[model samples]
Target: MTTRDALKIWIVEALSALGPSTVPRIAQHIWENHEAELRQSGDLFYTWQYAMRWAGQILQNEGKLSKAGPGRTWMLI
Candidate 1:
């Protein structure tokens, strides 16, 4: 899958696993959980900022997620 696609998939999995969480928190969890995968893939792994913006855009576009109180935490609805 493409980098953005991989990010989206990861976000979905993380949201399901952690429920609502801030982007940084999610990124930390994913980084720790998938360090092996990241090492094999190199820099396309995406940082916390990209994950946050990309996921919010993708999920908002798809209507699977929503902003809650205009903060970092995203709500899956």
Candidate 2:
């Protein structure tokens, strides 16, 4: 899958594991779990923080996730 696609999946999985989380928390999870694989594939041009933000936006657009409260937290729908 493309890096964005991988990131999107990671976003969902991170939410499932952590409930509502801020962008940084999700990014950290992605880095911890998938950074090596993404780097090996030469697809990690952007930081995991950026990738997670984009993925969260995509999921929000799809109605599978939502931003919560005021702290820039995201949660599964």
Candidate 3:
């Protein structure tokens, strides 16, 4: 899948591993664990952060993730 599409998977994996976490922490987790994949993602490497935010919102809308709460951390539902 494209890197933007991959964010949905990676975000869930990060939360499952790290528990509820801030956006930056989730991003760091993805970077640390998937740097090689990101490097190969072309334009997505530059836009992943923005795309991740959208992915999170989409997940929330789909009821797979909780709505943004205090501290703006994300959690799987």
Candidate 4:
């Protein structure tokens, strides 16, 4: 799958594991869990953390996830 698709899946999985999380927390989880695969994405892999936020935005738009509270934490819908 493309990086974006993979990121969306990772985000969902992270949320399932952690219940709800901030963007950085989700990003860290994805990095810790999928570092090898993410590294395979080449130079762009360095930007994966930032890409998680975009993935969150896409998920939010698709209504598969939601943001809550002042911290804008994310959780499954």
Q: Pick the candidate with the highest TM-score.
A: 3
Candidate 3 TM-score versus the reference: 0.92
Residue 45, candidate 3: C-alpha displacement in angstroms:
0.6
Model 2 clashing residue pairs (backbone)? none
* Tens digit of per-residue lDDT, candidate 3, span 1-77: 36577899999999999999999999999999999898888889888999999999989988999747579889999
lDDT of each residue in 1-77, candidate 1, tens digit only: 23556666777777788888887777776777766766566566555447557767888799987667357587678
**If the candidates were sorted by their TM-score against the true structure, best first, what order would they fall in?**
3, 4, 2, 1
Clashes of each: 0, 0, 0, 0
Instruction: Find the candidate with the highest lDDT and give its number.
Output: 3
lDDT of 2 by residue, 1-77 (tens): 24668788888999899889888788778778876776764545556567668788889999999997469689999
Q: Stretches of candidate 1 above 4 Å error?
A: 46-52
CA shift of 57, model 2, Å? 0.6
Residue 47 miss distance in model 1 (angstroms): 4.9
What do the candidate models score in CA lDDT, each in turn?
0.70, 0.79, 0.90, 0.86
Off by over 4 Å in 2: none
Residue 37 accuracy (lDDT) in model 2: 74
Output the better candidate (1/2) by lDDT: 2
Better of 1 and 2 by TM-score: 2
TM-score of candidate 2 on Cα atoms, chains taken together = 0.83
